[model samples]
Structure formats: C-alpha cells, structure tokens
Target: MEETSITAEPGKQEIVISRVFDAPPDLVFKACTDPELISRWWAPESITTTVEKMDTRPGGMWRVTQRDAEGNEYAFHGVYHEVTPERIVDTFEYEAMPGHVLLETETIEDLGGGRTKMTDHLIFQSVEDRDGMLQSGMEEEMTGPMERLAELLQSLKQAAPAR
Candidate 1:
C-alpha cells in the first residue's frame, strides 16, 4: 500500500497533491495521459466523464465533457504546451466560462523502487479566480476522483501478478 498526501496554499493560489503508487513511473504517467484511463476516474465519485478529443502532444488540443448527478454538463478544453512521457503542461479553460483560464503543468517524478510522485501546478490568471474555485468546492470535488485513482492503481498492481 502507498500513502497519499494533499496540500494547498490559499494565499499562493496553489494546490499540491502527492501520492505514491506501487507502479513504475511510465505506467503512472500513462494513466494520466491516456484518455481511457482518465475518464475512468477523472470526475468525482458518481459523476461521469467523456473525452471528446485527446491528442496528448505539444500543440495538440484536448476536450472533455463531464456530467454531474443531476445531468448538468460542463466541458473543458485545453491546448498542450508541452508533453513528455512523464510531464505535461497545458492551458485549460472551461467551455461554459471561457474567460476563466488556467495554466497547468503536471510533472511525474520517478522515485525508484516502483514509486512515482505526481504534482499538478495550476496557475490562474488572478487570485480572485483561484479563490473562487476553492470556494466552489473544488477541493471536495477532487477528493473522490483522487481516491478512485489510487484504487485504480491498486487494482493494476494486483492484476499484474496474474498476467
């Protein structure tokens, strides 16, 4: 079993989540980059996600549609600024609210011993926007999705021995 930690700095408009998974860095990175795997745990629990497009390369564009329990939908689109096997940088925006944009970079560090540390750094255009998201329950929404990701990795680890 691996440990997970999440941290946030309200003043800095930063949220950092760290989790140790019992999988190699490459595999862990793929779990994030692959649309199929992403959709499996992208939204909070009981919500659903659909990837309309996902071209994970420099200058490529990606879009995902998420629906909540009440059937309310939101779409997110992004352009990849940088894409490597273990790191990705992109500009993200919600289609419903186009003006609210965020620059996000995610890095995966190989910790050796079948462990990886994934960090997501999201930079908003203004502190107000960041604070608004926090007040909108972004942290709570993130909890279930992250937990599902950990469970997914655990299942992968268990299945590996049978393969």
Candidate 2:
C-alpha cells in the first residue's frame, strides 16, 4: 500500500504523479487504455463512471462522464495524439472549464519482478491554470481513483491463470 508520489513545482504549469503497481506493463497499460477497466477504477467511490467513447490510437478520441451521488454529471474528453505500449500523449479538457485544455503524457516503466511504474505529467496552459486546478482539490480528487486502480490491478492479477 505505497502512496502515489506527486511533484508540483512552483511557477510551473505541470504536475507529475508517479506510482508503482504489482502488475506487468501490459496489464497495467490495459488497465489504463481499456474503457471497461478504466470505468472500474477511474472515479471516486462517490461517483459512478460511464465511458462514452475510447479509441487508443494516434488521432483517436476518448470521453468519460461521471455522475455523483447527487445526480450531477461531470464530463471530460480528450484526443489521443500519441499512443504506444509504454507511453501515451493526449489533450484533456473538462467540460465545465472549456478552452482550458491541458496536455497529458503518461509513461509506463517496467520495474521488473512483476511490477510496473506509471507516471503522469499534466501540463496546463499556464501557471495560473495549474494553480487553479491544484486549488480545486485535484490531489484529493485523484487519490481515491488511484487507490481503486491499485486494487483493481491486484484483482486482475489474481483472476489470471498461472503463466
């Protein structure tokens, strides 16, 4: 149960988050790029997720919507500008804050011994926008989903047949 490591430099328009999971790169990558697996662990416990669309290829598009317990829906959409076995590059935009787009790059590093490391770099349009997101409780918002992802990975590993 290691914590996700995060780095946010002052005056920079980016945030980086890193974590290791007890799974191989292929399985970890599938958990991220697959819509069904994403829906299982991409939202906080208080929210239910719906995968509107996902196309994990260069120029492909993806969208996800989440509904809170209060019945309020939140949506996010992005385009896949780059995709590979170990890295993904995409643009992310929250519907409520239109025009405030951010570029996200996620990298998966094989850590050996049945483990993989994931790092997400989120680049905002400006430092102000990045600060705004941080102020909006971005870390808190991500903590649960990340923990859920770890749990889901463990479950998936258990379900697989012996190699």
Candidate 3:
C-alpha cells in the first residue's frame, strides 16, 4: 500500500496530495479521464458513484454523483480549464456548498520503468474553506478512493494484451 502525502500549510489556501503508482503515466491518465474507469474507483466500496458527464477537453463540464446506503446523494461538478495527458486543470464545486469552489491541478509525472507519480493540488477560495475541508475528514476519505484507483490501475495493466 502506498502512503498518500498530504501537505496543508497553515494560513495557506491550498492542499496538495501526492501518491506514486506502479503504472505508467498513460495508464494513470486514462484511468482518471475515462468515465467508466473513474466510476470503478472514484468512491469507496460502500458508496455507489455514477459519472453523469465527463468531457475531457478544455471548457468542458464534468459531473459525478455518489449515493450512499441511506439514499443520500452527493454531487460534484466541475469545469475543465485545461486538459492534457500529463496535466489537468479544473474548477471543482461540491453541490451542497454552492459557491465554495476550488481549482484543482492534477499532474501525472512519468517516473520511467512503468511507474508514475500523481500530484493533486487544490486551491480553495479562502483559507477558511481550506481549513474547513481539512477538518471534515477529507484526508481520511481520500485514502479509500486512491487505494481503489491503484487497484484498478493494476487490474487494467494485467488486462491489457501484450504489445
């Protein structure tokens, strides 16, 4: 299991999460941008997630909704500012919070020999918002999805036929 590194500097409005995967950059990028692949690992095992819309190009919109056992749905939608195999920039807004939007930049760094490092940088609108997110158990909640992503990537690599 890979440990996720989360850096949250006091008084700053940003949180950066980083993790390394045993898969190449292309594979990691595909898993993130593909709606089908995203649904498989975007949420925890106990939560059911559906990718309502996913447009990978710039100025596109994406939305995903997650339903829990009690029928509560949590929806998140974002607009893509930039999209590339190596980097993605988007605006993320949780539906419940209305106007609390954050900009996210995810970079997939190829480390050679079939390994890649994914770094997600999130900049909140304010320091209070950033601190609120940290206090909301966001760090713990993120681990599940990341672990699932790693597992899904491994499965994808094994399923791919020899080149």
TM-score of every candidate? 0.90, 0.98, 0.98
- Put down candidate 1 lDDT per residue, 38-96, tens digits, no spaces: 99988887779998999998999999999889999999999999999778999889888
In model 3, pairs of residues that clash are none
The C-alpha lDDT values of all candidates are: 0.82, 0.93, 0.95
What shift in Å separates residue 116 of candidate 2 from its native position after superposition?
A: 0.5
What lDDT is reached at residue 31 by model 3?
95
Kindly list the per-residue Cα lDDT of model 2 for residues 1-163, writing each as its tens digit.
7688878999999999989998889888999999999999998888999999999999999999999999999999999999888999999999999999999999999999989999999999999999999999989888888899999999999999876
Question: Given candidate 2, what's the lDDT at residue 152?
Answer: 93
Q: Which ten residues in a row have the lowest lDDT in candidate 2?
A: 137-146
The predictions' CA RMSDs to the true structure, in order, are 1.9, 0.7, 0.8
Model 3 lDDT tens row, 67-161? 99999999999999999999999999999999999999999999999999999999999999999999998998788899999999999999998
How many angstroms is residue 88 displaced in model 2 relative to the true structure, after the best TM-score fit?
0.9
Model 2 Cα RMSD, 1 decimal: 0.7
